[model samples]
Target: MKDKVKGLVVGVLLGSLLTGATAFAGTNTKISVVMENVKMMFNGVHKSTTQSIVYNGNLYVPAKTAAQTMGESFTYDGKTKTASFGAKTGTFKYLDEVSYARIDGKTNRLYFKNWTNPEGLKFTIAGQKYLHGIGVILDEPYSYDDQTISIDYNLNGGYKKLTANIGIDDYTRNSTNSGSLIVKGDGVELYRKDDMKGGDMPESINVDVTGVLKLKIVFEATLDNGRQIDIVLGDAKLIK
Candidate 1:
C-alpha cells in the first residue's frame, strides 16, 4: 500500500568482507551488461532496444545497464573499485561515479552493499559508492539463507501493464513481491514481482512486455521461523 518505487538490481561478489578476499573466486568469472542506446524512460514509458549478450564475461555498457535498465538505485565496491549511483536522476536520466561498470550497480530487494569475501565461500564486489570500500559480504543478503528463489529472462516484445515493472521483498517473513520489467519471456516473475517504495535504495518496477522466450526469473522464499533463501538476478532467478 506504500510503494513509491525506485529501481535497479544486479549484483555478485559476496566474500562477506574483505582482506585479500581469496583473490576473488571464480565460477567462470561472469559479467555482462548492455542496454543499447539507453532510451528506456520509465514514469513515461519508453524502450529502445539493440540488445547484445556477453553478460557473464563482464561487459555491460550503455552506461552501466542504464540504472538497472531504467529503475534507479545503484552500488558497487569490490575492494576499491568504487561505484555508487543513488536514485532519482533526471534530464535524460543519468548517474555516474566513473561508470564504465567494473562493478557497483546497486541491487534490488532493498540495498545490499559491503561485500567481498573471497576464499571463505565466495563474494566479489568491494568498491562502490566512491569506488573503493572493502568490507566484503558481496552476496548473501536475502536474509542468511534457507534457499529457493529463481528468476530467468529472455523476451523480444509485447507489453502494456503500463510498461510493466516490479520486484518485491517484504522485510522478512511477510513476503510480498511482484515482477514485470518489460522484456518478456518465460512468464517472468522474479521474487513474486513487486517491489517499490518511496524512492531510494534498490527498488524498481516498470513493466510492459509480451515477448517471452528465454525469460526465467523465478522465486521461492519460505521463512516465518524456519529459514530459506536463494536469489539470483541479472539472468533472473529466485528460490527459497
Candidate 2:
C-alpha cells in the first residue's frame, strides 16, 4: 500500500500487524519464491539474509514472498537506483533524511522506515494521503505471501477486512463532540474529517456539513481475526 501523507507531517508512529495466514519461516538462504504455486527463479540476482526479515514469526522477503508469490510485477534498477517487486512498483526516493517509496504514476507514497513490531515482525507503510495502501501478511516474506493454492490455482486461503466511514457535527469554540472514533493500528484505514461533521468522504454514510459545526470523520475497520483498526481523519481544525 502507498502512504499518501508525504508533504504532511509524519505524525505519530502508528501500530502494525498482519491479518493473514501463518508465516513461512525458513533458514535456507537460497529461498524459492512460488508465484501462484510456480517457482520464481531470478536469472541474474543478488541475495542477502532472505530469512532475516520475519513476519508472523517467519522470515519475510519483500521480493518473492509479497510480490512474486502474489503474481505481481517485480523489477530492480541499478541505474535509477531503485528496487521494485510485486503487484506494485515503487520508485525509491530520499526525502527529509529518510527513504520513501512512491508508486509509479500515482501521488501516493509508501513509507519504508524500519519497523519493529511484536506480532511475528514484518514491514509496514504509514502516512497516506489518498487511500491505496496494502497490508501484506506473509509467512516467509516471499516464499508464501499470497492467499492462493498453487496446485489448482484457487484461492482457498486469504484475509478479510471491514471498513466504514465516520462523521460528527455541532461545532463551537472548544467543543468535545461524541462519536469520537479511531482506527486500530494493525490494519488499513481511511479517515475523512473537516471543521464540521458532514465532511467529504469517498464513500460517505452522510453528507452536508455546512453550518457552525465541529465535526469528525473516522474510517473504522475490523480484521478477520477479531482485530480492529482505527484511522483518525487527517486534521482537526477550528471553525472560524
Candidate 3:
C-alpha cells in the first residue's frame, strides 16, 4: 500500500514537470522542473519517509521531516501563517533575538555575537570553542562589592523553558579572577553558580521558565587584582 501511494505521488510530480504545470503556490505562473526519487540518508542511515525531490536541479526534501531528522523541532502557526525550526519542537525564540527590558551593568551593555568568521562571539571552554553567544564585560574592576550585572528578559509568561551555556569568555583565560551566574524566574532564583572561572567548561542551564513574567540573569564579577570579567551566555534560547 505504501509503495502504491508513493508511486502515485511520483507519477503526479512527473506529469506536472513534463507539462510545465504551475508551482504549488497557487500562482498561474508556469515553471519547468525535474522530479526524481533519489534515496535520502541522514547520519549514515536511510530515511525512507524523507524522499528527495529534484526541482530546478536542486534537491529538496520535506522541511519538517528534515528538521526532525536533524534532532530539531518544527512548528507552524496557522493564524500568523509562519513556520519555525528551532531547538524545541514547538515555537522557539533565541534569547539574543529579543530585546532586554533592562540591563543594570556597571559598564558595557549586553551584546549579541554569532560564530561566523571576521565577526562573531568567540569563546573557549574546556578547550572547545563556541561560536554563538550573548556576552557582557565590565570596564573597570571594583573592590567595594561584587560588580553586579543584572539583565531582565520579559517572557510575559509565554515560554516553558530557557536553555543556555553560562561561562567566562576565553579572552580572559589568563586572569585568575572568577565570576558568578544566577538565573531567576519571576523574581525567584532558579539556578546559581558562585564561582565561574575562565577556561573552565561552560555550565549547561535548562530551567523551567513557565509562568515567568520577568526573567533575570545576574552576573557577578569577583574582582581580583583589578581585573575584568567576561561573562558569556552562550546559545541562550527560549522554548515554547
Candidate 4:
C-alpha cells in the first residue's frame, strides 16, 4: 500500500511539471505588439514628427519634441539636469524618490514666495494672506522698508512688444507706502509709475522693444508712514 501511494504522488508531480512546460512552450509563439502614434497640435497644426510611446501603461513623449510643437525653444543639460526655454529655466531634482521639474521665472500671476528678484534690496513677503494669483507681495512685517524687485528677460530680436500689468496688492486693505514700477532696456528707463495704492486695480503698460537687447521690469517701494506697503507687477509678457 505504501509503494502504491508513493507511485501516485510521483505521477501527479510529473503531470503538473509537464502541463507547466506545455504552457511555457505555447507562450514561445511570436506576437506582434502594436503601438499607437500620438499627434500633438497647436493652433490646428501638427507638432510632433517622432512617435510617442507607452511604457508601464503610461504615455511618454519626448520633452524637446513636445516643446517644439508649441513653438517654444527647449534645451536640456544632462550634467546639471536643467532644462531651459527661451528666457525661462527649470531644474530637475529627485524628491522622495520622485523626479520633479521646477521652473524659475515669473508669470502673469505669481505667489509672493515664487517671485524672483535678482536686482533689489533684500526683502520678504509678510502680512495677512490673500488667495488670489494676481501679483507679488514685498517686505513682510509691514514697517518703514524700502526695496526694489525686478524681472529680467532676453528677447533675441524675436518679440517686438512688451506689456506689464502693475498694481498694489488687494490684501493690503489699509496701509501707507509709496512705490514705482519702471521698465528699462539697456539701463534706460522706458516707463515708470509712482502713484498706486492698496486695493487698486492693476494698470496695463505697453512698450515697443523692436531693437532693444535686454529688458528689465523694476518695482521700487518706500515706506511712507503707518505700516509697510506692498507693490506688485501683476503681469509681464512679450508679444511678436
lDDT of 2 by residue, 121-239 (tens): 22211322322222212111233212211111111112122232222211111222212332221222223333322232323222222231222222222222222122222222111
Compute each candidate's TM-score over C-alphas.
Answer: 0.19, 0.20, 0.60, 0.42
Give the Cα lDDT of each candidate. 0.30, 0.26, 0.68, 0.49
* Candidates sorted on lDDT, descending: 3, 4, 1, 2
Model 1: ten consecutive residues of lowest lDDT: 92-101
Off by over 4 Å in 2: 1-66, 87-240
Which 10 consecutive positions of candidate 4 have the poorest summed lDDT?
7-16
Model 3 compared with the native: what TM-score?
A: 0.60
Q: Best-fitting candidate, measured by lDDT?
A: 3
Query: What is the lDDT for 238 in model 3?
Result: 88
Over 108-181, each residue of candidate 3 has an lDDT whose tens digit, in order, gives 34557643333564755555565556776643454433377788988899999988888877777766778888
Q: Give me the displacement of residue 191 in model 1, in angstroms.
A: 36
Report the lDDT tens digits of candidate 1 across residue range 1-240: 012223432343333332231233367553333332334454676744533222445523333445554554556667867655554222121111112112222233211222222222211111102221111111234544322333222233322221212222222212232222223245444223433221213333333333443443333333323332212122111111
Question: Candidate 1: where is the Cα deviation over 4 Å?
Answer: 1-41, 47-63, 68-78, 87-240
Give one clash count per candidate, in the order shown. Answer: 111, 31, 0, 3
